[model samples]
Structure formats: structure tokens, C-alpha cells
Target chain A: MTTYYTKSHEWIRLDGEEATVGITAHASEELGELVFVEAKDEGTEVAAGDTAAVVESVKAASDIYAPVAGTLSGFNTKLSDEPTLVGSDAEGEGWIYKMTVSNPDDLKGLLTAEQYKSL
Target chain B: MSDTLHQTPLHALNLELGAKMVPFAGYEMPIQYKAGLMAEHLHTRSSAGLFDVSHMGQLRIAAKSGDVRDAALALETLIPADYAALGVHRQRYGLLTNDEGGIRDDLMVANMGQDLFVVVNASCKHQDADLIEKALGDRCIVTRHFDRALIALQGPEAQNALTSLCPAAADMKFMDAIETELAGVSVTLSRSGYTGEDGYEIGIAAKDAETVARALLAQPQILPIGLGARDSLRLEAGLCLYGNDIDPTTTPIEASLAWAIQKARREGGSREGGYPGADIVLRQAREGVSRKRVGLMAEGRAPVRAGAKLFADAEGTKEIGVVTSGAFGPTVNAPVAMGYVATEFADVDTALFAELRGKFVPVHVRAMPFVAPGFKR
Candidate 1:
């Protein structure tokens, strides 16, 4: 399994043809407390950098972009009831959704964990 | 991040408490502490929360001839309130009006025996001071108290926390002001606050502000709150933020603040039409305004923010008005907002749609405040 991160603070863990996606901890912290989360529905085809989800805090709302082109398979519906999980565990239990990578070459554009931290 | 931002007397203490400092009204003040905005807001509703409001401008208006009525009448010329009728030790809410009948700023005026004490918004202080000086300087001595620091103790347990410091403060009713001593420092105490909760606003010497704040925070029920929670609290309480809910383009009647205009200043009264914009304001009071401010409750969990346009239909074609102040009200456990709407659509429970994130979200025009106020009176 290879884990990649985007400059916009999205993280993806590639497992064969499928990948799990969520926002990075740094992005969640900057957004403060999360009050609502709206993820894209299953079977939706998304392009890289397309808006995939929305996370709202008490102060403002932020959009989560797709890290790589793929078909969204499922979302973590648990976040709909407990949005703050994103703030507590952004990269783990708070994963936003899973998608099947349409173009494996898209993975090469992502950054390693160390490179993401440096940015 | 600019070095030119002004620092309050409690600036060092806020840093010590791990507060997030942000620029507001030319001052680098705390937006929230380690507890965060939601925690601070909920804590203020259930327990005691201390706020460093020294950034607000405090002024003293005294009569040149030492007559309190002279100063009150002089102030009445600038604002629409009947300050001359304001009894001793009583305070009244007022607004500074321009010649066009628009609100310049909202303020609190207290008849504190020899002088009328005033507090104005921090962002409008300089202009407020200059306007007062230029308008009434000949009849009254307008002295801005930059040497003073203001603190507010708010919440259900606020009285319990404050009474421990000054026993007399607990007896003061809502909108009452008195001189008292706190932590050995002479201070002015008022049984009023911006939050809907029952609380007190204390004024003290700038040198002793940190000491008073420390002493209050030492109490078990009292926690230091910041501006983030302050905004949410006042919004839930249906209070108008000067720059948000009320501004230069909003008149008293248009803002639904006609209650602040006393009978003496209205049409067919003893002292009719002496203040600024009396002709238009008094006429509006009798005939009514074109648009009015109202509270809005979101139909869903999605928060509708300020500047979002309001539409007459769900399809969002006809734009009626725009949201002025909005947030996820922690106490109400939902998204709440206040905005101006056509007077015809301002009735309670009038269905409206707000354009949020490209989709029109259903909203209802509800009567403010979203939460009931807990004033001591």
C-alpha cells in the first residue's frame, strides 16, 4: 500500500486499484471545529482537483477536492452524524470516501508524507 | 500580523492563556482560547465566562456647569434616545444618527450621577468621539477614557462568580450602573452585557485590568472567553452587531429598533423632533418602513453565512434581501441568522429560501432572539 498527499491537504492511501481519501490533519486543524460534512454520492465520476465534498465549521465552510481522477465507490456516512471526528482523527476513522482509480498515472503527481509535511 | 495593531491591557494574559490572537477593530485581540469557539460558547451559556472588552470605547460626558440634565439633553441632540428622562443610575440603549436618518453607531448611555457614561463599538470609537466632541463639546465636556479597561462576566453562573468579588454588584438590576470596588480597585459596574445571559460589565483602571481578570478567572465557574464566542452569543441573543445587523444605511425603524426611541422624541411628544434625522425617523415610526430585520432559522444543518442572498422562491430568482449576521448557534444547536427582508415577508414563520453554496436552502423568518434572554430584571 502506498499513501500519497496533495498540496491542498487531501490524503489518499492506494490499495491496488482502490484508494481511501480524507483531508490531512493540518487542514482540519486550520478549519477549526467541523459542524457539518457533505460527501459526494457513490458511483459519481470525479476528476482530479474537482470539488468532492464540503466541510463546514462554525466560522466558515471549506471544500474538499478530489486528489486523483476516480469513480467514488462509497463514503464514510458516520461523519454525517459526528463531523468533529474529522478534527480528532482526520486521516484515520474520519476518512471521507473510497474510490477506484481510473488512471494509475495520477498517483505519480501526489507527494510522499515527508514531502507533504515540508510543504 | 501587522505591528500597528493595538494591544489591550489583558493582551499578555490572553497570550498566557493560549488564546488565538486575531486582528479586530485595529486591536490584536483573542478570538478564542484553548477551549475553542464551540466549547467557549457553550461554557458561557451554562457557566461563567469573562471577556476582555477593553477594546470598546468608554467615554465620560459631564456638563460644563455641573448639571446632569444639561449633559443628557446635549447628548439627546446626537442620538434619538430621551437621555434627559434617563433616571439616575439607569442606563439606556442609544444610536448615533446621521442627518440622513441612518445609524452611525449603537451605544450604551448611563446616568451615573455627575456624568453620563457612554460605551461605543471599538471600530467606531474614533468617529464617535469626534462626532460627540464636534456636536456637543460646547455644552458638555466629552472625555474619552483611554486609561480604562472594560471586562464582562457573562452566563447563568455569572452572578455567583461576580458576587464573590463585589457583593453590591449582585443587587444591581438590569441596565443599572454603580461605582464599586473589586479586588481593591475602584471600578464602575453595570448589570448588563452583550450576551443574552444575566451578567455584568465592569470598568476599571487600565493598570489594574489584568489583576481583576486574573481574580475573576481564579473562580472555579469563571472561564476567560474571547471574541468568537462573543459573536455567537450576541447573535443568539438577537443583538445587532454595529457593522453587521445595523450600519450607515440602516435606519432605526428599518432595523426594527424603534423600541429604543423613547416617546418624548417621537411625533406629538413633549420634545418632538430635536435629534438628527428626526423628520424621516419620526415619520417612519408612524407610517412604517419598507424593509425590516428578522431572525432566520435554517431548515437543515447547513449554515447560511453573511452576504448570502435571500430569495422569494426556492428556485432563487427574486432576491429580496441579504443576510447580515449568521453562524451555527451552539446553544440553539442549529444554524441561525438575522437579515433584512421586505416588511411583507417579515412576519413570523414566513417561509423564505437562502442561497447557500449554489443551492437554495429553505429558511423560516422567526422572531428574535433565537434564544430567550436571561436579563436580571
Candidate 2:
């Protein structure tokens, strides 16, 4: 398994064709407290860089874009009642969704952990 | 406006406390701290929250004769409030009205015995001062206090924390403004705030602002809050932001603030219709306005943001109004908003639809003060 990040701040962990995704801690910190989040439903086909979810913080709302094109395999239903999880634990239980990658080549375009850090 | 952003007297202290700075009214102000907006808002509701509101403009209106009543009478020419009847050490919410029967800015006016202590919004202070000087300059002396800082101590435990330093603060009723010393520093303190919480707004010398703010934050029940929580708190409280819910294009009558216009200033009263746009305002008071401000309770968790058009039906036909301010209310735990709607649809519980994203979301006109106010009065 390998993890990659997008310049827009989402992180994706790839396991074969399956992957999990969430925003980075840096993005969560900048967004402040999360109040509401709505993710695309399971089975929805999302393209790379499309808005996979919408997250609202106390200050403003933002879109959580998909890093790679895929079919959403699962949605984080718990976020509806507990959106703050994204800010409290962005990389773990706060994961926004799971998906099946459409093209493995898309992974090569993503940033490494070190590259994401500098961004 | 200049590209250079100004900093308040408490800028360094706010930075030290880990504040997230943002540009507001041309000033770099703290929007939230390390605990974030939700924590700061909830903490304020349960305990006390310290806020640096020094960016607001503070000024004093004094008559050449040294009589506050004379000053009030002169000010009555600009605003439609009964300031002349305002008791000593008492504050009243007021507005600067334009000649066209519109609101220029909202303000707080405290009768300070010899003069009226006025506070205006940060963005409008300069223009407000110029207006007062241009309009009432002959009868009243308008002195802008650029050297003063305003601090707000709000929430449930605010009284207890404030009394710890100024015992007289405990005796002040709501809207009471008194000159008192806190920790040996002189401050013109008012038993008032915008957070719908029982609290006080302390007007102190800019030089002593940091010292006074530090002392207040030192209380066990008090935490430093920022503008993010302040906005949510006021929105929940149903108070209108100067430039948002109310503006130069909106009149007090249309904005549902006619109550602030005392009977003395209304038609057929003793001192009737001396203020600007009095003819139009008085007529509107009697005949009613076409549009009215109403509180909106969004049906779902998604906040209906400002500028969203309101429709009579879900089909997006028949546009009725526009949202001016909306936010996810932390205390209400739901999306709360305020907007203008046709008067016929402005009644409480009237169902309305707000266009959000690309769809019309069902919202209802609800009574304001989403959370019960905690005023000492």
C-alpha cells in the first residue's frame, strides 16, 4: 500500500484498485472547525479533481475534490452527525470516502508525502 | 479604502494567543483563536468570552453649552432615536439615517451626563464623523476618540468575572454605562454586548487596553474569543450587522428596528419628525413598508448563505427577497439566517424557500433571538 497527496490537500491511500481518501491535517487546520460535510453517495463515479464532497467550517464552506478518478465505493456517513471528526482526526476516522480507482496511472501524478509537505 | 490594513492595540496580544488574523473593516483582526470558533462560542455561552473590539469607532458628542440634553437634541436631527430623554449613564441603540429615509449606520449612544458617548461601526466611523460634523457641527462638538479601545466581555459568567475587578459593575443594569476603574485603569464600561449574553463593553484608553484585556482573560471563567464567534453569537441573537442585515439602502422601519425609534420621534409625538427622512420614515411607520426583515430557520443543516435569493415557491419563480446574513449557529446547532422578504410573507412561521447552490431549500420565517438572551435586565 502507498499514500499520495494532491496539491489541493486531499490524501489518498491506494491498495491495489481500492483507495481511501481524506483531507490533510494542514488543510483541516486552515479550515478551522468543521460544522457540516456531505459526501457523494456510494456508486457515484467521480472524475479526478471533481468535488467529491462539500465541507463547511465555522468561517466558510469548501469543496473536497477527488485526487484521482474513481467510483465511490463508500461514503463516510458518520460525518453528517459529527463533522468535527475531520478537524480532530483528518487522516484516520475522519476519512471522507473509499473508492475504486479507474486508472492506476493516475497515482503517478500525485505528490509524495515529502512533496506535499513543502506545498 | 487603502490597501494598507490597520492593526488594533491588542494585535500583538491576539497574535500571542494564537489568533487567526483576517482583514475586517480595513483592520487586521482576530477571527478565532487556537480553540477555534465553536469552542470560543460555546465557552462564551457557558462562561465568559473576552473580545477585542477596538476597531469600532468611539466618539463623544457634546453641546457647546456643556449640556448632554442639548447634545442629544442636536443628534436627534441625524438619528430617529429619543436621545434627549435618555437618562444619564444610560445607553440606547441608534441609527444614522440618510436624507432619503435609509440607514447610514447603526450605533450605540450613551448619555454620559455632560456628553453623549457614541460608538459606530469601524467601516463607517470616518464617514459618520464627517456627517455629524457637517450636519450638527453648529450645535454639537463632535470629538472622535482615536486613542480609545473597546473590549467586550460577554456570556453567562461575564458579570461575575467583571465584578471581580469592578464591583460597581454588578450594580449596573442592562444598557447602563458608567465610568469606573478596573484594576486601577479607568474605563467607560457599559452593561451591554451584541452576543445575546449578559456582558459589558469596556471603553478604555488605547494605552491601557492590553493591560485590561489581560486582566479580564486572567479570570478562570473567561477565555479570549474572536470575531468568528462574535458573528455567530450576534446572528443567533438576531442582531443585525451594520453593513449586512442593515445598510444605507434599508430603513429602520423596513429592517424591523422601529422599536428603537422611540415614540417621541414618531408621528404625533412631542418631538415628532425632526430627524432626516422623517417624513418618509413617519409615513412608513403608519402606512407600513413593502418589505420587512425576517429571521430564517433553514430546514436542514446546510447554511443558507447571504445573497441567496428567496422565492415564494420551490420552483424558483416569484423572487421575494435576499438573505443578508446567514450562518451555522453553534448554539442553535442548526443553520440560522436573517433576510428581507415581502411584508406579507414576513410573519413568524411563514414558509419560504431560499435558493441554495442550484436548488431551493425550504426555510421558514422564524422569530429571532434563536438562543434566549442572557441580559441582566
Candidate 3:
């Protein structure tokens, strides 16, 4: 599966009409250990660039903005129980929420795995 | 990244762990790991957290063959802790003082056999070293262990986790130091920690530090925690940090640290009491102190962080004191802190106000250890 990254350190995986999303390895690295992840409720409507989650660490709190507008289809509720999963597999199982893209074109502004590596 | 802050050997590791680096005591230290303050705090209560305290200054107080005990006693006169009473393989918390009865810095002292192992705050290392040297120059040898590593493993699972790296650690008691190999690195390991949790502070050679650190990280429940969590964890445990909670302007009596003073020393007849500030300290022990350190709990999400002005309200209208350490209590899930207030407001349940952003935020005197300390001791 082709994985993409956002400047904010989120990753979006497009699986046809449905998509999977989580923080990128870089974001997890930047955020440190994920202590708290307040994910957007399933079915919550969010615009591109809208804050969809709140990630807090022992030192500070940060907002996780949506890379593309969409209604969050589902969230990885398990994060509430095991926040460290974000640190272990931030790009894979650490995915925060799933959403339907409002415009797939919005993904163009984001970075590819290679592009993120370059940045 | 700031030049003003000194970076430790693990600075790059902090970046690898996604630590939020902050300038502290002239060094760049991790304030928090990936987990935000609250979760990191919760994890500390339930599990173990790894803290890189390498920034703290490590020093040794040595006495040639015959003068060890006397030198130790001379050092004890300044700080009010019972050192001679301390058993071998044990440790004690100590405070350094000035000519007047004022605190210099709070430090941890351990008997490392033939010498004394001391750890002082990084910010005050220069002054502490100078003070120790000046006080004992002609008497004994005081050397700096600059090229060493100090890591604290604190929490409920601290002992078990650390024991994995050092098998002999299981039999160790709180405040005891044992020479053991940790993750293959030779180190002087002590079963003592600051978070009020069951743990150890490992002192190892500087060159082999990274190897030892990586080995400890390999254990379960051992997460790379930062200074932010370290402060919050200690505060939640009702422990004092040197600069903020205890400084040159404060005394052990006013800081509610009277218990640290030895009874014999207070009596002045013998053991150790000829050092600086003994007069005022003895007087306070005989009489009573006016202002005392107390815990304050503020209501709401916004933290009444450090430096907030505190006042006794209504009938006892007085600009009583200011907060030394205040922050949102992650464990209590509320705002909690400690500060020095007048006798009138020092009582638990006494109503007080914390000036936050130009407004008086109502707070009440609360019992400290906002969360129960789970020290294995």
C-alpha cells in the first residue's frame, strides 16, 4: 500500500473510497511517547486543515489537523487504552482515525514517503 | 538546539524518542517524551520511567586514609542530615547552606565507600562545587565526577525492571548502593529514586554511559522520560526540587524540611554543628518557624504554574507568599502545587488565592503528595 505523510506528521492510506489515517513515524518521533490521543469521534465532519485530534505528551499538547476534509468514518479507539502504540508503530497500527476524503486532490499538497524523507 | 543550553550524551537519543527539548540549568534536557505530561505521569505511577539526570553534577568527597569520618562530619555540619548515623550501602538527602540560615542547594548524598558520592542540581553545580571546595579545601579532597552518567528508574515496576539489567539488584533495599554490571556496563548502582517510587539511580563511567543507557531502555516499563515528567512526578510525590522549591532565599525550616535536621546536631552538644547558619537553624528547632511550605490546590484546567502570587484572603488580608512550584496535577487530574505561605495560611484547607494572568485564582491549602508516592521503601 502506498503511504503518504502530512507536514503535521500524519499519514493517510487511501483504500479506494475509504481511507485509513494515523500519525507518521516522524510525527510520533517528534511528539515523543504518545501519552494521550483524543481522536475525532467516528462520523465527525471536519474540513481540510481542521483539527481532528489532540496529541498530548508529558511536556506539551498539539493539535492533529486533517489533511483532507471528510467525515471521520471510524477511530482507533484502542489508542485510549494503549497510547504507546503510537510510538511503536506510529505509521501502521497507530493510525488515529479513518475518514472519507472530501477531495483526493488535497493529498497533492501533502508529502509522499520519499518527499517527507527529503524534507 | 539553542547554544545557551548544554547537551548531554543522550541529546540525540532524545530526538530519536521524540522528546521536547528545553533549556534547563544551562543544558538542553528533554522535558517530556512522546506521551504528554498527563499520560507520562500516569505511566510513572503505574510503571517505570527512565530519566537521564546526567546534567546533574556528580562529585566525590574523599578523605585520606584516616580523616574520612571527620571530613564527613564537617560536611554534615552545613547540611542538616544525619550522615554518620547513615548505615553503609545507604543514602540520604542533604541541603547545603550559607553563613546565614539560608539554603544553598538540595542534594543527594550516598556513602560510596572510602568517599562520599554527591549529586547536586545542574544549574547550581558550579556554586555547589565551589562551596564544598571552599568549605573543606585544607581539610579533605573534593573532586568532580564530570565524566559520569546518572539515570533514574522510577515507578512501581522500577525495581523489577532494573533488576533485569542487574540481577543482584533484587536484594537491594531503598537508599542502598551496590556495585553491579548494568546492561554489560560497569556502574555503581543505587536503589534510590526521586519520584518517591521504587527505583535506582545508576552512576556509570561517561564513556560507557550510552551503552548502559541503551541497556536499561531495553527493559520493559522503562520509557525514556524527560524533565517535564520528572518535575511533575516529583511534585506529585510532594518532593522538592532544588532551585524552584528550595533556594538560597529559603531555609529547611521555612521549606517544611525540618525533619532533615538531626536531633543531636540541633542540640549542639556534639556530633556535627559548627558549620555555617547553625545558629538560626538551631533557634528555629528550639522555637518555631513563622512561614512554612504548604501545598496548594487550584480549581480548574488552567494551571496556576510557578511564580504565581499567593495571598491569604478576607480577615487575614496579607500578601503572604508566592508559589515556587505549581502545575496541573496529571495524576489528580487537577491543578496542584507547593509554595511558602504564612502560618495563618499554611494550614491545610486554608483558603488562598493564586494570581494567574492578573486575576486571583481561588485555591485551598491541600495535603501534598497530590498522588500517593509508591516508593518500594
List lDDT for all candidates, in order: 0.92, 0.92, 0.79
lDDT string, candidate 1, B39-97, tens digits: 99999999989999999999999999999999999999989999999999999999999
Q: Kindly report which residue stretches of model 3 are placed more than 4 angstroms away from their true locations once superposed.
A: A1-119, B314-317
lDDT of 2 by residue, A15-111 (tens): 8788999999999989888888887778989999998888897657899899999999987889888898998899999999999999988988999
State the lDDT at B250 in candidate 1: 95
Shift of residue A44 alpha carbon in model 1, Å: 5.1
Per-residue accuracy of model 3 over B61-155 as CA lDDT, tens digit each? 88755545655785785687777766666788888887778899888887776778888888888888888898787776889986677888888
Which residue pairs of candidate 1 clash?
none
- The CA lDDT at B283 in model 2 is 91
Per-residue lDDT tens digits of candidate 1, residues A1-117? 778999999999988888899999999988888888887778889999988888998878889989999999878889888999999999999998899999887988899999999
- TM-score of chain A, every prediction, order shown: 0.95, 0.94, 0.91
Tens digits of per-residue lDDT, candidate 3, A4-30, equal 788777788888767788887877776
lDDT digits (tens) for residues B219-275 of candidate 2? 999999999999999999999998899998999999999998998988888999988
In the predicted model 2, the residue pairs found to clash are none
